[model samples]
Target: MFKKEITAGAKSKVKSSVQRGIRTKVVETYPLLAPHIDEIIPKKSQLDLLKLPDRVSLYALNNEPLFWQHMDDAIVPHLRVVHQFPHCFSRIGIDRGAIRFVLSGAALMVPGLTSAGGQLPEPEGQLKEGDVAVIMAEGKEEACMVGQLKMGTEDMKEKKKGVAIDGGHCLGDGLWKMSID
Candidate 1:
C-alpha cells in the first residue's frame, strides 16, 4: 500500500500494556521469535511507536525498526528486521526476472515463483493460504519482500498462473525506505 516514501508523523513511547499486547501478537504470529523476544524487545527498553500515513503503525526499538502493521492487519517485519532472523518464516524464492517487478511494488504472479529459478514451499511443509512468507530473489542474500500467500501451495501448482502473493513490504518500496528517526 505504501507506494511512495513515507515519514513517521508523530512518535510516542509505547505503554507497558500496549507493548505487552504487541509482544503477544508478535509471538502468536511468529512462534520462532519467541525465544529471542527479549533480544528483539528488551523488557526494560523503551519501544517507540511511530504513526505513519494511511493508518500504518511502526514499532521500533531505539532507532531500529522492528515491525509495522497496516490498519489492523497482521504485523509485517521490516526487511532489515527479517534479515536478522532469516529462518524464522516460510520462504518463496522468485526468479531473477521477477525481481524487478517485485521491487517495483507489483503483486507477485505465479509464474515468477513457479519458474525454473523460483523455489516453492516444500510439499511436506503444508503451507496454507494467508501464511506470511519471506520473498527471496535469486542471487539476493537477503529477503526482498514479506507478504501473505494468495493461494495454497497445491493450488499454486495446479493453477500455474495468477497472483501468488499479496503485496506487503518490499525492498526499495516505501516501507523499506521509511525512516523511524
Candidate 2:
C-alpha cells in the first residue's frame, strides 16, 4: 500500500506547511501559550517525522498534557502513524474519534465512561488470538472491560525485557492509561 507519489520539493513544501499549521493551531487553541510559542516550535518539530525510528514519542508539549477531550462527534480526525515501532503498542486515550493501522500488534484505548454503556461501545465480534484490540473511550464510572490483549500486558509493564509493549487488562478509565507505545 505504501508507494512513492510525491516529489522532493513538493514533499518539503507540504511538510513545512503542516508544521506551520500545527504551530498555528496549538497557539490559537491555547492562547495562554502565546508568549513562548516561538521556543516551543523547535521542540514540536515534525521534520523527519516519517523518518523517525520506530517508537512512540510522548511529548507533554510544555508540561501540558497533549491529550484532549474530544466532544465534536461530527468531526472525525484521522491520526496516521506519524511515528511508531513494528511491535510497539500505542496507549492512546481519545476523547474523540481516531483511526490507525494495525502494525503487527494492537492499539488499546479506553475513553471515559458515563454509565452502563456510557459513551463507549462494548467489545464485539470474535476477536482473533493475535488480533489487535482497541478499547474505545467511555464515561468515567461505567466502562468495565476484561480481556486478554497481547499488547496490553506489554504496555502496562514498567519495562519490556524482550517485548516492546506492556500487555495487561484495564479496569476503569484512570487518569493515565497504558498502551503499546
Candidate 3:
C-alpha cells in the first residue's frame, strides 16, 4: 500500500490488553511464530502503534517495526521482522533477475517464482492463497519483500503466469524508507 515515501505519523503506546491481543493474533495466524513470540513481542516491552496512509496500522517495538495491518486484513510482519526471524514465515524465492523489480516494489509474477532459480514450497499448494509470504531473492540471505499471495502456490505451478502477490512491502518501498524513530 505504501507505494510512495510517506512521512511518519504520531506514535502511540499500545495498551497492554491490545498488545496481548496482537500477540495472540500474530501467533494464531503464524503458528511458527509461537516459539519466538516472546522475543518478537515481549510481554513487558511497550509496543508503539503508528498510523500510516491508506488505513494501515504499524506496530513497532522500540521504534523497530514488527508488524503492520491494513484495515482489518490479516496482520503481516514487517520486512525487518521477516529478516529478524526468517524461518518463522512461509517464504518463496525469485530468480536473481527478478530481484531488482521486487526491490523496486513491482508485484510478484508467477514466472519469477516458477523459474529454475526460483523456490516455492515443496509439494505445491503448501502455502495457500491469501496467506502472507516472504519474498527472498536467489542467493540472498534475507527476504526482499513481504506480501499476501494473490494465487495459491498450487495455482501458480499450474498457471505459470499472472501475478503471484500484489501490494507487497519491499526493501526500498516507502514503508522501508520511513524512519520510525
Name the top TM-score candidate: 3
Best by lDDT: 3
Q: Across residues 52-128, which tens digit of lDDT does each residue of candidate 2 receive?
A: 11222222333322322122111101121111111122122223232121121233332222223323222332333
* Backbone clash count for every predicted candidate, in the order shown: 0, 25, 0
Model 3 is weakest, by summed lDDT over 10 consecutive residues, at 120-129
Using lDDT as the measure, what is the rank order of every candidate, best first? 3, 1, 2
lDDT of 1 by residue, 16-84 (tens): 899999998989999998888888988888899999888988999988989888788788888887999
Please give the RMSD to the true structure for each candidate, in Å: 1.4, 15.7, 1.2
In candidate 3 the C-alpha lDDT for residue 38 amounts to 97
* TM-score, candidate number 1: 0.93
TM-score of every prediction relative to native? 0.93, 0.23, 0.95
Ranking of predictions according to TM-score: 3, 1, 2
Q: Which stretches of candidate 3 lie over 4 Å from their true place?
A: none
Clashing residue pairs found in predicted model 1 = none
